[model samples]
Target: MIGNDVIDLALARKESNWKRKGYLDKIFTADEQAMIVRAENPTLMVWSLWSRKEAVYKIHNRTAHFRGFIPLKIACQADGKVLCGGQFYFTDTIVTAESIATVAVLEERQLSQICYLQDREEVVKKEGFPYRKTNSKPVSISHHGRFEQIVTLTD
Candidate 1:
């Protein structure tokens, strides 16, 4: 399965104060927090890790049919893998001046393609996954602020 997330840096800067007391403790593991503290750009590091966690959460949600918002529980390691509920997920992060994007897939799934979409509805029409057919290859789409990204897993 594939999952993805995007964060708009401009909007995030205007809206979030990740440095506030206890904010890091609420969402990041101790190791992650240390990485942030050591980062050259803490804001970008925070959002990059956040995007990765959110992406992994999406895949966990679909596969386990569960839902929750425990960001700290999703441990994102420095090596670009996420650990949650005894499962390990592979993840990738992309950081641009304008945004941060992350993609996650099950450890066993091979990613076939990655693309950007201006309109997600086009996927339904183009891929013929009207109800988002689960039997079909898993694809994840995420949009934030001005950007939209997708990750697809192949057979």
Candidate 2:
């Protein structure tokens, strides 16, 4: 399975205050918070980390049928890995000044098999989750402010 997320920087800045009291503590583990503190751009780091967890969580949710916002239970390691419910997911993230996009897969090697696309017309929702209409491969779609990203795992 594969999952993806996108975050628009401008919209995030306007919508979220990561520095608000207890916010970081609520969203990040201690190690992740330290990473944020030491980051050159703390805000970007926060969102990058958030996107990674979210991307992986999407895959986890699909497999586990889990529902809820349990951010702390999902951990983001520095090496593009996410740990949740004792399972590991690998992530590839693209960060720009305007947005951050992340794609995650169950196997590390599948990272290269992720296809990013812009054609939304081929996407359809099945049971509230997006999938490719042609092949029915699980498709992930995320949009934030000015950015929208679509991804699917290729055979």
Candidate 3:
């Protein structure tokens, strides 16, 4: 499976003009751009969408060749979600048929908001919960979802 990891340029490195625009078009769909217009700085908004798209690509296992994927018709949504790449759609409709997303914010610490839209739930950060162990080891050391979720992760 393919995986992609995106970081906020503001939190990592400065982005060049070409990198910003190129990635903006490469990642977000038209409707998504409009929905995120509150940000006066095109850079930050694009950056947020970038993170979400990257996460979706990872979940969809299309990160190996993101360019093969297209927005809207193939793998992007207006409300900040993504489908799988078109190239593999016929063989694997599940990828592009559903939506997936992840978001990262630069708060005091690096906070990542992971969303698996197909599951109709988001991966959120959780704390202060009873610890469950599996195989005599910590099951996981991450957060859980607030909304009803069918899938979970432990790492």
Give the candidate number with the greatest TM-score.
2
Clashing pairs in 3: 84-95, 84-96, 126-143
| Candidate 1 structure quality by residue, lDDT tens digits, 1-155 | 77899999998889999989999999999999999999999989999999999999988988887788889889999999899888999887889889999988776344334444444454553333222343345567877888778656543
Clashing pairs in 1: none
- Residue 65 of model 2, lDDT score: 96
Q: What TM-score would each prediction reach against the true structure? A: 0.86, 0.96, 0.39
Give the TM-score (vs. native) of candidate 2: 0.96
lDDT of 3 at 151: 23
Better of 1 and 3 by lDDT: 1
**RMSD from true fold, candidate 2:** 1.0
Distance (Å) between predicted and true CA of 17, model 2? 1.0
Q: TM-score of predicted model 1?
A: 0.86
What candidate 1 gets wrong by more than 4 Å, as runs, is 108-118, 125-135
Counted clashes in each candidate structure: 0, 0, 3
Model 3 scores worst on lDDT over the 10 consecutive residues at: 89-98
For residue 141, model 3's alpha carbon misses the true position, in angstroms, by 15
The local distance difference test score of model 1 is 0.80
Cα lDDT listed for each candidate: 0.80, 0.92, 0.35
Model 3 lDDT per residue over 1-155, tens place: 22233343433344345245565555556666674565675555554455455444443432243343544433434443355554331111111112222332212122232222233123233242112332121111112222221222222
